[model samples]
Target: MNEQYPVLPGAEPFYAENGPAGVLLVHGFTGTPHSMRPLAEAYAKAGYTVCLPRLKGHGTHYEDMERTTFRDWIDSVEEGYEWLKERCGTIFVTGLSMGGTLTLYMAERYPSIRGIVLINPAIDIPAIRAGLAAGDELPRYLDSIGSDLKNPDVKELAYEKTPTASLLQLARLMEQVKGELERVACPILIFVSNEDHVVPPENADIIFRGVRSSDKEIVRLKNSYHVATLDHDQPLVIERSLRFFAKHSK
Candidate 1:
C-alpha cells in the first residue's frame, strides 16, 4: 500500500543548498506525507531544505496505525528535525492537526527551533470529552471507527478507519501539549477555519493565548473546511506559511 501511494516529486535524498531555511513538516493523523508534499516542495523550490517524515504506522496498512502511540509520532518529528538541523542554520517546524500538536511538542523540547506553523492543531477533543470522562468509552468507540476515516472534503483522499486507542492517546497528548505551550518560545503562525467541523476553532484560541512566544499570529480561513491544506484556502495557507518562514528565518 505504501508503494501505491504517490511519493512527493523531490522527496527523496532530501538535500538542498542556500535554501530559505530547514523546514520539518508533519502530516495529520491517518494522513501520509502526501498531505504536506506540496508545501514541502514549495519550500524546497523557494530554496529551503524541507523534510516531511512519514509518521509511525503511516503510509501503510491501517492496522499499523493502531500499534503506534503519540510518543512515536513525536519521536519521528524529532528525528526529522535533527536531520534538518545538521544541514541548515535555522529550523522551522510545521504540522496539520495531530501534526500541529507534534510541532508544538517539538518546540517545547527543542529551544533551537526558529519558528512553528500550525494548521488546525488539535489542543482538545471536545467531541470525545464526555466519552473520555467515562473511562475508556471513547477509545472503545474510536477503535470501532478505525484510523482511516476522515471528514469529507471536495478533494477527499483515502482515509483508514481511526483506531480507538490511538485517538485516546492523541487526546492525552493534546492535553500534555496544552500544558507545555508555555514552554514554546519560538515564533508561530497558526491557521484556523471558521467553519471547521472537526477540531474546534477554540483550539486555536487556546494556543494563541498560551504560547509563550512573543511573535505569534493566527489567520482565520473563512471558506475552508477542516482540511484547509487542500481546501480553497490552501493558497493563503501556503503564502502565510512562507511569509512566516521568511520572517523568522532571518
Candidate 2:
C-alpha cells in the first residue's frame, strides 16, 4: 500500500516503558494511533509498558486501506502483543471500535492475555450488511464515520472515506468473533455509548451475554457517541480502566 497521504504528527505509533505489566493499545478501522493516544499515555504515566501500533492500511491515504484485509490489521496487533510479551510480566489488551473487536479476538486466541478493555466494540454493524447487499454495485468507498465524539471540540484522526473491501472483511471477522466469545476467559471491561451512531448499543448486550468471562463488566456512556475514547466522557474510560486493571491484573 502506498502512503498517498502523509501520516499525521501525533497519529504515529506510541510506545513507552514503565512497569513490568504491558498494555497493548489498538486503534480502530481507518483510525490512527491518535484516537488511542490519550488512554495509552494514561497507562504509560501509571507506570505500565504501553505499545500502540498503527494498524495496517490505517493512518495513511484512503486508497491504501483498500489494499489491506482484516487479517493484516490483526497481524499488526499480534506483532505488538508479542513484543510486549517478551518484556512484560503480565499483558493486557484494550481497543476501540474495530480495535475492540481485535482485542476480543486476541483474548480468545491468546490465553496469556490477562485482561481486556473494549470501547464500543464493533461485533455487528448493519452498514456492513447493506454494503454487502449492494455488492459490486456499491462504490469503492463511503463517507467518513470518524469524530463521532459528544464533545464537539474533539476529533478523531481517521480516514475521510471508508474502504468498502476493508469494511466487508471487518464484517466477516466480526461474524467469526461473535461466535467465539466463550473463548475469552479473561476479565473484560466494556464501555459502550448509549447514543453510538456507528455501532448499535445492543452489540454490547450481545457481547456481555456471549462472553464466558465471569469478571466481565459493561459500563454505559450516557453522554458520548461511538468514539467514546475521545468524547466528553473520555476521562471515565481512562479512570475506570485503570481501576479495572488494578483489580484484575494482579
Candidate 3:
C-alpha cells in the first residue's frame, strides 16, 4: 500500500529507510504484505531498513491472481531484494509459507545474503503435487487457506478463494526450490508449527535436512498454527529472528 501501486486497505507494501543493513520480508501465496507487516515493522523498529513487498496478483483480489504465475511472484521478491541490495551492505531475507520458499530461492542465487528467517515455509505439499499430477481440469477457484492462526481473534487478510492454477505454480516452485536447497548456504532460522493444518510440519524437517547452511536452527511453534507470525508465538518469532539477524548481520 505504498506509493508504488494500488492495493487493498492494509495490504500496501511498506518500506522503511533506516540503515545500511536491511531486511526484506516476503508474504505467502494468495496473501498480501499485510501478513508480514508486523514483522516488517519490527525490523524497522530495530533501525534496519525493511521492505515488505506485496507479491504480484495478491493484496487485491483472488481473480487478479489468475493472470499471474510463481515467476511473477518471484519477480516481486527479487525487486525487493534488489532494493535492499542497492542500499544495504548487509541484507537479510525472511518469509512466511511460499514467501519462505522465495527467501530460500534468494539465498540460493545470492550467496552474499547475510542470513534468513522462515516461518512455515512450504516446500513440498503432497496434495498440491498430486493435483498437479492428475492433469485434470481443475476448478477455477477453491476454498481459502488463509487465516490459519491459532488465535481466534486475529485473522489474516488472505484471499477468500484460491485460484486453482496457482497451486500448480506453487508445486512447480517447490520442486524448483527443493532441488537447490543444497545451494542455500546462508545462516537460517526456521520456524515450524507443530500443529499446522496447511503445510505439513514435515516441511521443516525437509528444509533442515536439505539446506547446505551449516548454521541452521529449527524451532517448533507449539502454540501456533500455519501463520505463526500472527499467532500466539509471534513475540517469540520476532525476538528470535532479531537475534538471528543481529548474530549474522555483524
Candidate 4:
C-alpha cells in the first residue's frame, strides 16, 4: 500500500552535530536527501552541525506524495530548523529546487538566519501554470524531474514519476515565496547552471533581482545541471558553500 511504503535505502535524512554553527541542507521536490548527503558529510567533516530533513511525503512512493500539500513539506523543514536551533548558536540554510523555495520562506520570516545558499532553485515554472491555464487536465503522473546531473555515472534517488496534484501545491508555494522575496534580508548565494534542463537559468536572475540583500551574489555553475549537488561541480559547490557559511557566521 502507498501508506505503508518503505523508506528507500539511502533516502534517509542526514543529521550531524559538532560546532555551534549549524546548517540545514534541503533536497529538491521528489528528491530524497541522498543527493544532499555528500554536502552534509562535507559540513560534518568541517566540524559544523548539519541537518537534512526528508519532506513529509518524499522518500517514499509517488502515491504518498500525491496526498501531501506544500505546507506539509514546510513543516518538515521547520522541524529540522527548530532542532538545529536548540543545538547550535548560528544557522544557515541551503536547498535545491523546491527546497530553495522553502529556504526563501524561512529567510523571509526569520531574519535571524545567517544566510542561504540555493542551487538552481525552482521558481515560477511556466509550464505548470500554462498547462493549468489552458484547462488541460494534467495526467496523474508526468515525466520524472530527477537526475539532471552532468555526471553520467551519478543518479539521484527520486520518484520516477511526478504527481500532478503536488505540482499545484508547488505552484502555490512558489507564488507565496515569490511575493515575499523582498523580505529576505539575509546574505544570499544563488547558484546558476548555464545549461540546466529542469529549471531555467532565469530563476537565478529573478531571485537575484528580487531580494534586497546587500551581500547577495550569483555563482554560475558551468559543469552541472539542476541537481548540481551531485553533478560535476559538486566539489566547487561544497567549497563555495563552506566559504559562504564562514562569511555570514558570527
Candidate 5:
C-alpha cells in the first residue's frame, strides 16, 4: 500500500505558535497541504500562529479519497479549528476551492471565527452534475495517476481523475452550506477569477448574496484560473490575506 501510495513530502504533524490570533489555511480537493503551505508559512512569518492540516483522504492514496465522505473533510477542519482555538484568542479561516467551502462552513458553525479569506471557493458542483448526466464518470480509485504539481505559471495543477462519487457528495454538502451562509457574521474576503474553468464564476455572486456578513469584499483576479492560490495571483492572495489578518487579529 505504501508503494502504491507514495507519501507526498512536506506535509506532516501540523505546526503553529501560541498567540492571540491563529490563521488556518486549507487546500482544495484532491490537493495536499503543499497547496496552502506557502501562505501558511507567510502567515507564520508575520507572527501569527498558522495551521495547515491535511484534509481527510488527501496527501495520501487516491483510494482513500473514494472511501471518505464530505463529512470526513469537515471533521478534519473541525479538528484543526479546535487545535487553533486552544492557543489563540481569535481564529481566522482561509481556503482554496473546496478548502474555501470548508472555511465558509466553519464560519457558519463557529461564530468565534474572527474573519475569513476565500480563494476561488467552490460552492457548487454544476459541472460535476453535468458530467454525471452525460454518463462520463471517472474512476473511484485512481491512486496511480500522476499529478500536475509543477510550475503554476506554465501549467495548471489538478487531479488527473476527478472522483464522481466524491463530487456528488460535495454537491450535497454545498447545498446544505448555502442555506447556512446567512448565519455567518464575521468579515469575509473572497478572491475570485474572471476565467476559472473548473468552478463557475457565478459562485462568487451566490456567495456574496448568501453571506450575511456586512463586512465583505470580493477581489476579481483577471489573469487566473480556479487555483488562484498557485496561479499568477498568488502574491496578491498572500498580501490580501495578511492584511485581513492584521485588521481583525487585534
Candidate 6:
C-alpha cells in the first residue's frame, strides 16, 4: 500500500543553529516543514537556533498520511522540542494550522516554553466534524487544503489531496486540545486571517477566549488567508513574533 505521490523539492525538515534561544517551527497536516522554512531561516539569522521537523506522516504521500494519527504528529513535535532543548537555554514555539494545534498541545504539556506564536491554529472547525460524521461514506481523500494563501504567486508544498481518516483523527485532536486550553498559560501571540477558507475565523476567538494565559494577544491578518506564514502578512507575523519572544525571553 505504498502509493507514490510527487514529493516536492525543498519540502523537507530544516534546522539551523546560531544562538542559545531555540525556536521550534511546526507545519500543518499534509504540510512539509518547507512551509515554515522562510520563518525558520529568519529566526536563525536573528541569532536563534531553529528546528523544523517533518511531522510523522506529512511531507510524503497522502497514503502515508492516512496511516498517521494525531498522537504520531505530536510525537514529532516533542522530538523536535527535545532536540532544541539540548542546544539552547530558552525556547519558543510557533506553528500554522494543525501545527499550531500541536504547538498549543506542547505549550500545555511542557511548561518550559518561553513563548508561543500560532498562525491560524485549528481547534474546532465545523468542516472537520462534518467530514468525520460523514466518515467512510466519503472518498478516501478530498481536495487539497494547500495553497490557501491570498498571494496567488505563492504556493504551499503540500499534498494535493486530503486524507479522510487523518481528518477524523485531527478532529479528535482539536476537541482534546480545546478541553485543555486552560493548561496553556505561556505568553502567546496568535495570527488569524479574516478571510481564511480552510479554517473558520471563529477558531481564533475560541482560542483567545479559552486560554488562561495572562499575556496573550491576537492579530487579525487583513491581507492573508489560512496559510499566513507564506502570505502577504508574513513580515508582520515574523516581526511581531520576534518582539513577543524578546519581550518574554529570560
Q: How do all models score by TM-score?
A: 0.87, 0.97, 0.96, 0.97, 0.89, 0.96
lDDT of 1: 0.77
lDDT of 6 at 178: 93
Question: Taking the candidates one at a time, how many backbone clashes does each contain?
Answer: 15, 0, 2, 0, 0, 0
> How does residue 219 of candidate 3 score in lDDT?
95
lDDT of 3 by residue, 1-250 (tens): 2233356899899999998899999999888888888889999999999999889889888777877888998899999999988889999999999999999999999999999999999999998877767776677788999999999999999999998888888988999999999999989999999999899999999999999989999999889999998899999999999999888877
Encode model 4's per-residue lDDT on 1-250: one tens digit a residue.
2345889899999899899999998899999999899999999999899999999889989989999999899999999999999999899999999999999999998888999999999778998888666655678788899999889999999999999888889999999999999999899999989998888899989998999899999999999988999999999999999999987785
Summing lDDT over every window of 10 consecutive residues in candidate 3, give the lowest-scoring window: 1-10
Per-residue accuracy of model 2 over 114-205 as CA lDDT, tens digit each = 99999999998887888798888988888998988889888889999998888888998899899898999899999999998888988888
Model 4 segments more than 4 A misplaced: 1-3
Clashing pairs in 4: none
Q: Quote the lDDT for 224 in model 1.
A: 76
Candidate 5, superposed: residue stretches over 4 Å from native: 1-6, 11-14, 133-158
Q: Which 10 consecutive positions of candidate 1 have the poorest summed lDDT?
A: 141-150
By TM-score, is 1 or 2 better? 2
The candidate with the higher lDDT, 4 or 6, is 4
lDDT of 4 at 94: 95
TM-score of 2: 0.97
Q: Which segments of model 6 are wrong by more than 4 Å?
A: 1-7
